[model samples]
Target chain A: MLLQFIIGLVFGLGLIVSGMSNPAKVLNFLDFAAIRSGTWDASLAFVMAGAIAVTFTGFKLVLRRPQPLFGEKFHLPTREDIDTRVIAGPAIFGIGWGLSGFCPGPAITALGFGTAAAVIFVAAMLAGMWLARFIANRPSMSGIVTPADRVGA
Target chain B: MPATSFTPVASAAGGALIGLAAVLLMALKGRIAGVSGIASRLLPPYEDREFAGRLAFVAGLVAAPGLVWLVSGRLPEQTIEAGMPVLVVGGLLVGFGSVWGNGCTSGHGVCGLSRLSVRSLVATVTFMATAALTVFIVRHWG
Candidate 1:
Protein backbone atom coordinates (compact mmCIF):
# COMPACT_ATOMS: atom_id res chain seq x y z
CA MET A 1 0.00 0.00 0.00
CA LEU A 2 2.79 2.39 0.82
CA LEU A 3 4.37 1.51 -2.51
CA GLN A 4 1.18 2.22 -4.41
CA PHE A 5 0.68 5.47 -2.58
CA ILE A 6 4.15 6.69 -3.40
CA ILE A 7 3.78 5.74 -7.05
CA GLY A 8 0.45 7.54 -7.30
CA LEU A 9 2.01 10.56 -5.71
CA VAL A 10 4.80 10.56 -8.25
CA PHE A 11 2.30 10.06 -11.07
CA GLY A 12 0.12 12.92 -9.90
CA LEU A 13 3.05 15.21 -9.41
CA GLY A 14 4.29 14.30 -12.86
CA LEU A 15 0.89 15.23 -14.27
CA ILE A 16 0.93 18.68 -12.73
CA VAL A 17 4.49 19.29 -13.82
CA SER A 18 3.68 18.21 -17.33
CA GLY A 19 0.89 20.78 -17.45
CA MET A 20 -1.66 18.01 -17.99
CA SER A 21 -3.89 19.11 -15.10
CA ASN A 22 -4.37 22.30 -17.05
CA PRO A 23 -7.44 21.83 -19.20
CA ALA A 24 -6.69 24.85 -21.31
CA LYS A 25 -3.38 23.34 -22.38
CA VAL A 26 -5.02 20.01 -23.12
CA LEU A 27 -7.70 21.67 -25.19
CA ASN A 28 -5.12 23.65 -27.10
CA PHE A 29 -3.12 20.50 -27.78
CA LEU A 30 -6.16 18.83 -29.30
CA ASP A 31 -6.78 21.79 -31.52
CA PHE A 32 -5.39 19.98 -34.54
CA ALA A 33 -6.98 22.29 -37.02
CA ALA A 34 -5.24 25.21 -35.42
CA ILE A 35 -2.52 25.09 -38.05
CA ARG A 36 -4.62 27.57 -39.96
CA SER A 37 -4.71 29.84 -36.95
CA GLY A 38 -1.04 29.20 -36.12
CA THR A 39 -2.10 28.01 -32.67
CA TRP A 40 -1.31 24.28 -32.79
CA ASP A 41 0.04 23.05 -29.48
CA ALA A 42 2.10 19.90 -29.85
CA SER A 43 3.66 19.72 -26.42
CA LEU A 44 1.54 16.73 -25.40
CA ALA A 45 2.84 14.64 -28.24
CA PHE A 46 6.31 15.20 -26.88
CA VAL A 47 5.01 14.28 -23.46
CA MET A 48 3.69 10.97 -24.70
CA ALA A 49 6.84 10.25 -26.60
CA GLY A 50 9.02 10.82 -23.55
CA ALA A 51 6.77 8.67 -21.37
CA ILE A 52 6.56 5.84 -23.86
CA ALA A 53 10.31 5.80 -24.42
CA VAL A 54 11.10 5.48 -20.74
CA THR A 55 8.34 2.98 -19.98
CA PHE A 56 9.27 0.86 -22.95
CA THR A 57 12.82 0.52 -21.69
CA GLY A 58 11.89 0.12 -18.02
CA PHE A 59 9.08 -2.42 -18.50
CA LYS A 60 11.25 -4.61 -20.70
CA LEU A 61 14.02 -4.65 -18.10
CA VAL A 62 11.60 -5.47 -15.28
CA LEU A 63 9.66 -8.15 -17.18
CA ARG A 64 12.85 -10.10 -17.78
CA ARG A 65 13.39 -10.63 -14.06
CA PRO A 66 11.09 -13.71 -13.98
CA GLN A 67 8.93 -12.14 -11.24
CA PRO A 68 8.09 -8.68 -10.04
CA LEU A 69 10.06 -7.05 -7.23
CA PHE A 70 7.16 -7.57 -4.80
CA GLY A 71 4.77 -10.14 -6.26
CA GLU A 72 4.92 -13.80 -7.17
CA LYS A 73 3.91 -13.08 -10.74
CA PHE A 74 3.48 -10.10 -12.96
CA HIS A 75 -0.21 -9.42 -13.39
CA LEU A 76 -0.53 -8.29 -16.97
CA PRO A 77 -3.25 -8.02 -19.59
CA THR A 78 -3.44 -11.11 -21.80
CA ARG A 79 -6.18 -10.30 -24.27
CA GLU A 80 -4.89 -9.43 -27.72
CA ASP A 81 -7.89 -9.06 -29.97
CA ILE A 82 -9.38 -5.66 -30.74
CA ASP A 83 -13.11 -6.06 -30.58
CA THR A 84 -15.97 -3.56 -30.82
CA ARG A 85 -16.03 -3.16 -27.08
CA VAL A 86 -12.42 -2.00 -27.23
CA ILE A 87 -12.95 0.47 -30.04
CA ALA A 88 -16.41 1.73 -29.18
CA GLY A 89 -15.70 2.17 -25.52
CA PRO A 90 -12.60 4.31 -26.05
CA ALA A 91 -14.28 6.27 -28.81
CA ILE A 92 -16.94 7.34 -26.38
CA PHE A 93 -14.28 7.98 -23.80
CA GLY A 94 -12.38 10.17 -26.22
CA ILE A 95 -15.39 12.31 -26.92
CA GLY A 96 -15.81 12.90 -23.23
CA TRP A 97 -12.12 13.63 -22.77
CA GLY A 98 -12.13 16.09 -25.62
CA LEU A 99 -15.31 17.76 -24.47
CA SER A 100 -14.00 18.41 -21.00
CA GLY A 101 -10.22 18.24 -21.48
CA PHE A 102 -9.92 15.76 -18.65
CA CYS A 103 -9.02 12.09 -18.27
CA PRO A 104 -9.23 9.89 -15.19
CA GLY A 105 -5.78 10.39 -13.71
CA PRO A 106 -5.45 14.11 -14.27
CA ALA A 107 -9.06 14.75 -13.37
CA ILE A 108 -8.65 13.06 -9.99
CA THR A 109 -5.45 14.95 -9.31
CA ALA A 110 -7.15 18.20 -10.30
CA LEU A 111 -9.66 17.67 -7.48
CA GLY A 112 -6.96 18.85 -5.10
CA PHE A 113 -7.00 22.20 -6.85
CA GLY A 114 -10.46 22.67 -5.31
CA THR A 115 -12.15 23.87 -8.49
CA ALA A 116 -15.95 23.57 -8.60
CA ALA A 117 -15.67 22.17 -12.12
CA ALA A 118 -13.31 19.51 -10.84
CA VAL A 119 -15.73 18.55 -8.07
CA ILE A 120 -18.71 18.39 -10.39
CA PHE A 121 -16.72 16.47 -12.98
CA VAL A 122 -15.54 13.94 -10.44
CA ALA A 123 -19.02 13.49 -8.99
CA ALA A 124 -20.59 12.99 -12.39
CA MET A 125 -17.79 10.64 -13.33
CA LEU A 126 -18.49 8.46 -10.31
CA ALA A 127 -22.17 8.43 -11.12
CA GLY A 128 -21.25 7.35 -14.63
CA MET A 129 -19.14 4.52 -13.32
CA TRP A 130 -22.00 3.38 -11.10
CA LEU A 131 -24.35 3.41 -14.05
CA ALA A 132 -21.89 1.45 -16.19
CA ARG A 133 -21.91 -1.39 -13.70
CA PHE A 134 -25.62 -1.83 -14.30
CA ILE A 135 -25.12 -1.55 -18.03
CA ALA A 136 -22.28 -4.05 -18.05
CA ASN A 137 -24.37 -6.54 -16.07
CA ARG A 138 -27.05 -6.71 -18.71
CA PRO A 139 -26.50 -9.81 -20.85
CA SER A 140 -27.95 -8.20 -23.95
CA MET A 141 -24.72 -6.74 -25.27
CA SER A 142 -22.66 -9.59 -26.56
CA GLY A 143 -18.96 -10.07 -27.56
CA ILE A 144 -17.38 -10.15 -24.09
CA VAL A 145 -18.47 -9.33 -20.59
CA THR A 146 -16.95 -7.66 -17.58
CA PRO A 147 -13.86 -8.91 -15.76
CA ALA A 148 -16.20 -10.77 -13.45
CA ASP A 149 -17.61 -12.68 -16.37
CA ARG A 150 -14.15 -13.61 -17.54
CA VAL A 151 -13.27 -14.79 -14.04
CA GLY A 152 -16.09 -17.34 -14.45
CA ALA A 153 -19.72 -16.33 -14.34
CA MET B 1 -3.78 28.49 -27.51
CA PRO B 2 -0.74 29.94 -29.22
CA ALA B 3 2.24 27.78 -30.10
CA THR B 4 4.24 30.05 -27.84
CA SER B 5 2.30 28.84 -24.79
CA PHE B 6 3.40 25.23 -25.19
CA THR B 7 6.21 23.97 -22.98
CA PRO B 8 7.70 20.94 -24.62
CA VAL B 9 10.76 20.58 -22.40
CA ALA B 10 8.82 20.70 -19.16
CA SER B 11 6.12 18.47 -20.59
CA ALA B 12 8.69 15.87 -21.58
CA ALA B 13 10.34 16.02 -18.19
CA GLY B 14 6.99 15.51 -16.54
CA GLY B 15 6.18 12.73 -18.96
CA ALA B 16 9.40 10.98 -18.00
CA LEU B 17 8.39 11.20 -14.36
CA ILE B 18 5.01 9.71 -15.16
CA GLY B 19 6.69 6.92 -17.04
CA LEU B 20 8.91 6.29 -14.08
CA ALA B 21 5.85 6.06 -11.84
CA ALA B 22 4.15 3.59 -14.16
CA VAL B 23 7.27 1.50 -14.43
CA LEU B 24 7.76 1.56 -10.69
CA LEU B 25 4.19 0.42 -10.04
CA MET B 26 4.49 -2.48 -12.42
CA ALA B 27 7.88 -3.51 -11.12
CA LEU B 28 7.09 -3.19 -7.44
CA LYS B 29 3.39 -4.02 -7.12
CA GLY B 30 3.06 -6.16 -10.24
CA ARG B 31 0.03 -4.07 -11.12
CA ILE B 32 -0.87 -1.75 -13.93
CA ALA B 33 -0.78 1.93 -13.01
CA GLY B 34 -4.32 2.40 -14.27
CA VAL B 35 -6.11 5.21 -12.47
CA SER B 36 -9.65 4.35 -13.57
CA GLY B 37 -9.28 0.65 -12.89
CA ILE B 38 -7.82 1.24 -9.45
CA ALA B 39 -10.45 3.84 -8.62
CA SER B 40 -13.28 1.67 -9.93
CA ARG B 41 -12.15 -1.34 -7.96
CA LEU B 42 -12.20 0.83 -4.85
CA LEU B 43 -15.81 1.91 -5.37
CA PRO B 44 -18.89 0.28 -3.78
CA PRO B 45 -18.92 -3.45 -3.23
CA TYR B 46 -15.23 -2.85 -2.82
CA GLU B 47 -14.41 -6.56 -2.74
CA ASP B 48 -11.15 -5.83 -4.40
CA ARG B 49 -7.65 -7.10 -4.13
CA GLU B 50 -5.14 -4.63 -2.72
CA PHE B 51 -7.86 -2.54 -1.10
CA ALA B 52 -5.31 -0.76 1.03
CA GLY B 53 -3.09 -0.27 -1.92
CA ARG B 54 -5.93 1.21 -3.95
CA LEU B 55 -6.99 3.55 -1.21
CA ALA B 56 -3.44 4.62 -0.54
CA PHE B 57 -2.77 5.23 -4.20
CA VAL B 58 -5.82 7.45 -4.51
CA ALA B 59 -4.88 9.27 -1.37
CA GLY B 60 -1.49 9.91 -2.84
CA LEU B 61 -3.04 11.27 -5.99
CA VAL B 62 -5.31 13.56 -3.98
CA ALA B 63 -2.34 14.71 -1.95
CA ALA B 64 -0.01 15.48 -4.84
CA PRO B 65 -1.17 19.03 -5.46
CA GLY B 66 -0.74 19.92 -1.83
CA LEU B 67 2.80 18.65 -1.94
CA VAL B 68 3.44 20.71 -5.02
CA TRP B 69 1.98 23.78 -3.35
CA LEU B 70 4.36 23.38 -0.44
CA VAL B 71 7.37 23.17 -2.71
CA SER B 72 6.35 25.63 -5.43
CA GLY B 73 4.43 28.05 -3.22
CA ARG B 74 1.47 28.02 -5.61
CA LEU B 75 -1.26 25.66 -6.60
CA PRO B 76 -1.08 24.15 -10.05
CA GLU B 77 -3.28 25.79 -12.64
CA GLN B 78 -6.45 23.81 -13.35
CA THR B 79 -8.42 25.73 -15.94
CA ILE B 80 -11.72 24.12 -16.92
CA GLU B 81 -13.26 26.19 -19.68
CA ALA B 82 -16.16 23.83 -20.13
CA GLY B 83 -19.50 24.66 -18.53
CA MET B 84 -21.39 22.60 -15.98
CA PRO B 85 -23.47 20.59 -18.46
CA VAL B 86 -20.49 19.74 -20.65
CA LEU B 87 -18.53 18.57 -17.63
CA VAL B 88 -21.47 16.45 -16.48
CA VAL B 89 -21.91 14.73 -19.81
CA GLY B 90 -18.18 14.41 -20.32
CA GLY B 91 -17.74 12.91 -16.90
CA LEU B 92 -20.49 10.41 -17.50
CA LEU B 93 -19.04 9.30 -20.78
CA VAL B 94 -15.49 9.08 -19.43
CA GLY B 95 -16.40 7.20 -16.26
CA PHE B 96 -18.73 4.76 -17.99
CA GLY B 97 -16.70 4.36 -21.12
CA SER B 98 -13.44 3.72 -19.26
CA VAL B 99 -15.02 0.88 -17.33
CA TRP B 100 -16.74 -0.52 -20.39
CA GLY B 101 -13.51 -0.20 -22.31
CA ASN B 102 -11.65 -1.73 -19.39
CA GLY B 103 -9.07 1.07 -19.53
CA CYS B 104 -8.45 4.75 -20.07
CA THR B 105 -5.50 6.88 -21.21
CA SER B 106 -3.22 5.73 -18.44
CA GLY B 107 -4.21 2.10 -18.59
CA HIS B 108 -4.29 1.73 -22.32
CA GLY B 109 -2.12 4.54 -23.56
CA VAL B 110 0.80 4.16 -21.15
CA CYS B 111 0.89 0.76 -19.46
CA GLY B 112 -0.90 -1.50 -21.90
CA LEU B 113 0.92 -0.18 -24.91
CA SER B 114 4.24 -0.44 -23.16
CA ARG B 115 3.41 -4.07 -22.41
CA LEU B 116 2.99 -4.56 -26.15
CA SER B 117 -0.72 -5.24 -25.97
CA VAL B 118 -2.40 -4.97 -29.34
CA ARG B 119 -5.75 -4.19 -27.80
CA SER B 120 -4.24 -1.23 -26.03
CA LEU B 121 -2.69 -0.01 -29.24
CA VAL B 122 -6.03 -0.14 -31.00
CA ALA B 123 -7.91 1.47 -28.15
CA THR B 124 -5.31 4.22 -27.83
CA VAL B 125 -5.51 5.00 -31.50
CA THR B 126 -9.28 5.02 -31.45
CA PHE B 127 -9.53 7.39 -28.51
CA MET B 128 -6.80 9.72 -29.78
CA ALA B 129 -8.24 9.88 -33.26
CA THR B 130 -11.68 10.43 -31.86
CA ALA B 131 -10.34 13.20 -29.65
CA ALA B 132 -8.73 14.92 -32.61
CA LEU B 133 -11.93 14.69 -34.61
CA THR B 134 -14.00 16.06 -31.77
CA VAL B 135 -11.63 18.97 -31.33
CA PHE B 136 -11.79 19.80 -35.00
CA ILE B 137 -15.56 19.79 -34.87
CA VAL B 138 -15.95 21.81 -31.72
CA ARG B 139 -13.17 24.32 -32.17
CA HIS B 140 -13.33 24.77 -35.91
CA TRP B 141 -16.75 23.80 -37.13
CA GLY B 142 -18.81 24.65 -34.10
Candidate 2:
Protein backbone atom coordinates (compact mmCIF):
# COMPACT_ATOMS: atom_id res chain seq x y z
CA MET A 1 0.00 0.00 0.00
CA LEU A 2 2.81 2.38 0.84
CA LEU A 3 4.44 1.48 -2.45
CA GLN A 4 1.27 2.16 -4.36
CA PHE A 5 0.95 5.53 -2.68
CA ILE A 6 4.50 6.40 -3.57
CA ILE A 7 3.95 5.38 -7.17
CA GLY A 8 0.82 7.43 -7.36
CA LEU A 9 2.65 10.40 -5.91
CA VAL A 10 5.33 10.09 -8.53
CA PHE A 11 2.73 9.79 -11.26
CA GLY A 12 1.00 12.92 -10.05
CA LEU A 13 4.30 14.76 -9.90
CA GLY A 14 4.95 13.78 -13.51
CA LEU A 15 1.57 15.10 -14.55
CA ILE A 16 2.34 18.39 -12.87
CA VAL A 17 5.88 18.77 -14.23
CA SER A 18 4.84 17.72 -17.72
CA GLY A 19 2.14 20.39 -17.76
CA MET A 20 -0.44 17.73 -18.56
CA SER A 21 -2.26 18.90 -15.44
CA ASN A 22 -2.73 22.27 -17.04
CA PRO A 23 -5.80 22.31 -19.19
CA ALA A 24 -4.66 25.47 -20.98
CA LYS A 25 -1.38 23.89 -22.01
CA VAL A 26 -3.14 20.78 -23.25
CA LEU A 27 -5.69 22.85 -25.16
CA ASN A 28 -2.92 24.82 -26.80
CA PHE A 29 -1.34 21.60 -28.00
CA LEU A 30 -4.65 20.28 -29.34
CA ASP A 31 -5.57 23.54 -31.03
CA PHE A 32 -4.64 23.35 -34.72
CA ALA A 33 -5.18 27.06 -34.91
CA ALA A 34 -1.98 27.34 -32.92
CA ILE A 35 -0.20 25.35 -35.60
CA ARG A 36 -1.30 27.72 -38.36
CA SER A 37 -0.55 30.63 -36.06
CA GLY A 38 2.95 29.25 -35.28
CA THR A 39 2.09 28.94 -31.60
CA TRP A 40 1.64 25.23 -31.15
CA ASP A 41 2.99 23.87 -27.90
CA ALA A 42 4.52 20.49 -28.66
CA SER A 43 5.56 19.68 -25.11
CA LEU A 44 3.00 16.91 -24.84
CA ALA A 45 4.61 15.01 -27.69
CA PHE A 46 7.97 15.20 -25.99
CA VAL A 47 6.44 14.08 -22.69
CA MET A 48 4.87 11.03 -24.28
CA ALA A 49 8.06 10.22 -26.11
CA GLY A 50 10.07 10.29 -22.91
CA ALA A 51 7.53 8.27 -20.99
CA ILE A 52 7.14 5.60 -23.67
CA ALA A 53 10.86 5.20 -24.06
CA VAL A 54 11.41 4.49 -20.39
CA THR A 55 8.36 2.28 -19.99
CA PHE A 56 9.24 0.27 -23.11
CA THR A 57 12.72 -0.48 -21.81
CA GLY A 58 11.43 -1.08 -18.31
CA PHE A 59 8.75 -3.54 -19.39
CA LYS A 60 11.26 -5.60 -21.34
CA LEU A 61 13.35 -5.94 -18.21
CA VAL A 62 10.47 -6.63 -15.85
CA LEU A 63 8.54 -9.11 -17.98
CA ARG A 64 11.59 -11.41 -17.92
CA ARG A 65 10.69 -12.28 -14.34
CA PRO A 66 8.21 -15.10 -13.84
CA GLN A 67 6.18 -13.02 -11.43
CA PRO A 68 6.16 -9.63 -9.82
CA LEU A 69 8.38 -9.13 -6.79
CA PHE A 70 5.51 -8.52 -4.39
CA GLY A 71 2.68 -10.17 -6.26
CA GLU A 72 2.08 -13.65 -7.63
CA LYS A 73 1.19 -12.59 -11.16
CA PHE A 74 1.60 -9.72 -13.58
CA HIS A 75 -1.89 -8.35 -13.96
CA LEU A 76 -1.51 -7.09 -17.51
CA PRO A 77 -4.32 -6.86 -20.00
CA THR A 78 -4.90 -10.08 -21.93
CA ARG A 79 -7.60 -8.89 -24.31
CA GLU A 80 -6.51 -8.78 -27.95
CA ASP A 81 -9.79 -8.21 -29.69
CA ILE A 82 -10.55 -4.97 -31.53
CA ASP A 83 -14.17 -4.54 -30.62
CA THR A 84 -16.60 -1.69 -31.32
CA ARG A 85 -16.57 -0.50 -27.73
CA VAL A 86 -12.80 -0.02 -27.93
CA ILE A 87 -13.14 2.25 -30.95
CA ALA A 88 -16.35 4.11 -30.08
CA GLY A 89 -15.48 4.49 -26.43
CA PRO A 90 -12.15 6.18 -27.05
CA ALA A 91 -13.67 8.35 -29.78
CA ILE A 92 -16.21 9.67 -27.32
CA PHE A 93 -13.47 10.09 -24.69
CA GLY A 94 -11.41 12.00 -27.23
CA ILE A 95 -14.21 14.45 -27.80
CA GLY A 96 -14.48 15.02 -24.06
CA TRP A 97 -10.73 15.34 -23.65
CA GLY A 98 -10.54 17.84 -26.48
CA LEU A 99 -13.55 19.71 -25.18
CA SER A 100 -12.24 20.21 -21.65
CA GLY A 101 -8.56 19.29 -21.83
CA PHE A 102 -8.95 17.26 -18.66
CA CYS A 103 -8.31 13.51 -18.46
CA PRO A 104 -8.64 11.35 -15.37
CA GLY A 105 -5.09 11.64 -14.03
CA PRO A 106 -4.67 15.39 -14.22
CA ALA A 107 -8.12 16.04 -12.86
CA ILE A 108 -7.51 13.83 -9.84
CA THR A 109 -4.10 15.29 -9.23
CA ALA A 110 -5.48 18.78 -9.45
CA LEU A 111 -8.14 17.81 -6.97
CA GLY A 112 -5.35 17.96 -4.41
CA PHE A 113 -5.24 21.69 -5.01
CA GLY A 114 -8.85 22.03 -3.94
CA THR A 115 -10.05 23.71 -7.11
CA ALA A 116 -13.77 23.88 -7.68
CA ALA A 117 -13.38 22.80 -11.27
CA ALA A 118 -11.37 19.77 -10.29
CA VAL A 119 -13.80 18.86 -7.56
CA ILE A 120 -16.77 19.17 -9.85
CA PHE A 121 -15.15 17.34 -12.73
CA VAL A 122 -13.92 14.49 -10.52
CA ALA A 123 -17.33 14.11 -8.95
CA ALA A 124 -19.02 14.06 -12.32
CA MET A 125 -16.44 11.60 -13.60
CA LEU A 126 -17.09 9.18 -10.75
CA ALA A 127 -20.80 9.51 -11.30
CA GLY A 128 -20.31 8.80 -15.00
CA MET A 129 -18.24 5.75 -14.15
CA TRP A 130 -20.99 4.45 -11.90
CA LEU A 131 -23.60 5.19 -14.51
CA ALA A 132 -21.64 3.36 -17.20
CA ARG A 133 -21.38 0.27 -15.00
CA PHE A 134 -25.04 0.53 -14.15
CA ILE A 135 -26.02 0.71 -17.80
CA ALA A 136 -23.58 -1.97 -18.82
CA ASN A 137 -24.81 -4.30 -16.07
CA ARG A 138 -28.48 -3.78 -16.83
CA PRO A 139 -29.95 -7.04 -18.13
CA SER A 140 -32.27 -5.14 -20.46
CA MET A 141 -29.22 -3.61 -22.13
CA SER A 142 -28.09 -7.08 -23.07
CA GLY A 143 -25.79 -5.85 -25.78
CA ILE A 144 -23.89 -3.45 -23.48
CA VAL A 145 -22.33 -5.57 -20.80
CA THR A 146 -19.68 -4.62 -18.33
CA PRO A 147 -16.20 -5.77 -19.14
CA ALA A 148 -16.63 -8.18 -16.23
CA ASP A 149 -20.21 -9.35 -15.95
CA ARG A 150 -19.56 -10.02 -12.26
CA VAL A 151 -20.29 -6.48 -11.15
CA GLY A 152 -23.85 -7.27 -9.96
CA ALA A 153 -26.73 -9.57 -10.82
CA MET B 1 -5.52 31.08 -27.19
CA PRO B 2 -2.25 32.95 -27.33
CA ALA B 3 1.22 31.61 -27.90
CA THR B 4 2.59 29.20 -25.27
CA SER B 5 6.15 28.34 -24.51
CA PHE B 6 7.29 24.72 -24.69
CA THR B 7 9.07 23.06 -21.76
CA PRO B 8 11.02 20.29 -23.37
CA VAL B 9 13.29 19.55 -20.40
CA ALA B 10 10.59 19.60 -17.79
CA SER B 11 8.19 17.70 -19.98
CA ALA B 12 10.68 14.97 -20.73
CA ALA B 13 11.84 14.69 -17.14
CA GLY B 14 8.29 14.57 -15.92
CA GLY B 15 7.36 11.99 -18.50
CA ALA B 16 10.26 9.81 -17.51
CA LEU B 17 9.08 10.03 -13.95
CA ILE B 18 5.63 8.91 -15.04
CA GLY B 19 7.17 5.99 -16.90
CA LEU B 20 9.21 5.09 -13.87
CA ALA B 21 6.09 5.12 -11.77
CA ALA B 22 4.36 2.79 -14.22
CA VAL B 23 7.35 0.48 -14.27
CA LEU B 24 7.60 0.35 -10.53
CA LEU B 25 3.92 -0.41 -10.19
CA MET B 26 4.23 -3.26 -12.64
CA ALA B 27 7.39 -4.64 -11.11
CA LEU B 28 6.16 -4.59 -7.56
CA LYS B 29 2.39 -4.90 -7.70
CA GLY B 30 2.15 -6.59 -11.08
CA ARG B 31 -0.54 -4.15 -12.08
CA ILE B 32 -0.89 -1.70 -14.91
CA ALA B 33 -0.70 1.94 -13.85
CA GLY B 34 -3.88 2.93 -15.60
CA VAL B 35 -5.11 5.84 -13.49
CA SER B 36 -8.74 5.43 -14.53
CA GLY B 37 -8.67 1.70 -13.97
CA ILE B 38 -6.96 2.02 -10.62
CA ALA B 39 -9.41 4.69 -9.55
CA SER B 40 -12.65 3.35 -11.00
CA ARG B 41 -11.99 -0.05 -9.53
CA LEU B 42 -12.30 1.60 -6.14
CA LEU B 43 -16.01 1.93 -6.86
CA PRO B 44 -18.93 -0.47 -6.61
CA PRO B 45 -19.23 -4.10 -7.88
CA TYR B 46 -15.43 -4.11 -8.03
CA GLU B 47 -14.34 -6.00 -5.00
CA ASP B 48 -10.72 -6.88 -4.46
CA ARG B 49 -8.35 -7.46 -1.57
CA GLU B 50 -6.21 -4.62 -2.95
CA PHE B 51 -8.91 -2.10 -2.12
CA ALA B 52 -6.75 -0.51 0.57
CA GLY B 53 -3.83 -0.16 -1.82
CA ARG B 54 -6.03 1.42 -4.46
CA LEU B 55 -7.42 3.88 -1.96
CA ALA B 56 -3.94 4.76 -0.77
CA PHE B 57 -2.77 5.26 -4.32
CA VAL B 58 -5.64 7.64 -5.01
CA ALA B 59 -4.99 9.42 -1.75
CA GLY B 60 -1.40 9.90 -2.84
CA LEU B 61 -2.57 11.28 -6.18
CA VAL B 62 -4.87 13.69 -4.40
CA ALA B 63 -1.96 14.78 -2.21
CA ALA B 64 0.68 15.38 -4.90
CA PRO B 65 -0.10 19.00 -5.73
CA GLY B 66 0.30 19.92 -2.11
CA LEU B 67 3.71 18.32 -2.08
CA VAL B 68 4.64 20.34 -5.15
CA TRP B 69 3.42 23.50 -3.54
CA LEU B 70 5.53 22.76 -0.50
CA VAL B 71 8.62 22.22 -2.60
CA SER B 72 8.10 24.91 -5.25
CA GLY B 73 6.35 27.54 -3.12
CA ARG B 74 3.67 27.95 -5.75
CA LEU B 75 0.72 26.01 -7.02
CA PRO B 76 0.99 24.47 -10.45
CA GLU B 77 -0.80 26.38 -13.16
CA GLN B 78 -4.02 24.72 -14.29
CA THR B 79 -6.50 26.50 -16.51
CA ILE B 80 -9.98 25.19 -17.21
CA GLU B 81 -11.62 27.07 -20.04
CA ALA B 82 -14.66 24.86 -19.86
CA GLY B 83 -17.53 26.22 -17.83
CA MET B 84 -19.32 24.18 -15.20
CA PRO B 85 -21.77 22.66 -17.66
CA VAL B 86 -19.04 21.78 -20.11
CA LEU B 87 -16.95 20.31 -17.34
CA VAL B 88 -19.82 18.16 -16.17
CA VAL B 89 -20.53 16.87 -19.66
CA GLY B 90 -16.88 16.40 -20.46
CA GLY B 91 -16.29 14.56 -17.20
CA LEU B 92 -19.19 12.27 -17.98
CA LEU B 93 -17.77 11.43 -21.37
CA VAL B 94 -14.25 10.91 -20.07
CA GLY B 95 -15.41 8.63 -17.27
CA PHE B 96 -17.81 6.55 -19.31
CA GLY B 97 -15.60 6.41 -22.35
CA SER B 98 -12.38 5.50 -20.59
CA VAL B 99 -14.16 2.81 -18.60
CA TRP B 100 -15.86 1.41 -21.67
CA GLY B 101 -12.68 1.65 -23.77
CA ASN B 102 -10.59 0.11 -20.95
CA GLY B 103 -7.79 2.70 -20.95
CA CYS B 104 -6.78 6.34 -21.29
CA THR B 105 -3.65 8.28 -22.21
CA SER B 106 -1.50 6.84 -19.47
CA GLY B 107 -2.82 3.33 -20.03
CA HIS B 108 -3.25 3.25 -23.79
CA GLY B 109 -0.85 5.98 -24.84
CA VAL B 110 2.03 5.23 -22.54
CA CYS B 111 1.91 1.71 -21.08
CA GLY B 112 -0.02 0.02 -23.89
CA LEU B 113 2.21 1.51 -26.56
CA SER B 114 5.26 0.54 -24.55
CA ARG B 115 4.06 -3.07 -24.44
CA LEU B 116 3.32 -2.94 -28.20
CA SER B 117 -0.34 -3.82 -27.97
CA VAL B 118 -2.14 -3.48 -31.30
CA ARG B 119 -5.45 -2.83 -29.59
CA SER B 120 -3.88 -0.02 -27.60
CA LEU B 121 -2.30 1.36 -30.75
CA VAL B 122 -5.70 1.51 -32.39
CA ALA B 123 -7.15 3.16 -29.32
CA THR B 124 -4.37 5.74 -29.06
CA VAL B 125 -4.66 6.70 -32.70
CA THR B 126 -8.41 6.83 -32.62
CA PHE B 127 -8.49 9.02 -29.53
CA MET B 128 -5.75 11.32 -30.77
CA ALA B 129 -7.45 11.71 -34.14
CA THR B 130 -10.85 12.41 -32.68
CA ALA B 131 -9.41 14.66 -30.00
CA ALA B 132 -7.53 16.69 -32.59
CA LEU B 133 -10.61 16.92 -34.75
CA THR B 134 -12.78 17.88 -31.81
CA VAL B 135 -10.34 20.62 -30.85
CA PHE B 136 -10.20 21.93 -34.39
CA ILE B 137 -13.95 22.05 -34.56
CA VAL B 138 -14.36 23.60 -31.14
CA ARG B 139 -11.64 26.19 -31.52
CA HIS B 140 -12.05 27.08 -35.19
CA TRP B 141 -15.66 26.27 -36.09
CA GLY B 142 -17.63 26.04 -32.89
For residue A94, give model 2's deviation from the true position in Å. 0.6
Question: What stretches of model 2 exceed 4 Å from their correct place?
Answer: A140-153
DockQ of each: 0.64, 0.65
**Where does model 2 sit among the CAPRI classes?**
medium
Q: Give per-model TM-scores.
A: 0.93, 0.95
Compared with the true structure, the alpha-carbon lDDT of candidate 1 equals 0.82
- Name the runs in model 1 displaced over 4 angstroms: A139-153, B1-4
- Model 2: residue A18 alpha-carbon error in angstroms: 0.7
| lDDT tens per residue, model 2, B1-142 | 5456899999999999999998999899888888877777788876567788888878888889999999999998877889999999989988988877888898888999999999889999988888889889988884
The collision pairs in model 1 are none
Tens digits of per-residue lDDT, candidate 1, A1-153, equal 788889989999889888888888888888888867778778888778778888989999988888878887777877777667788889988999999999998999988887889889988888877777667766784436634212100
In candidate 2, clashing pairs total 0
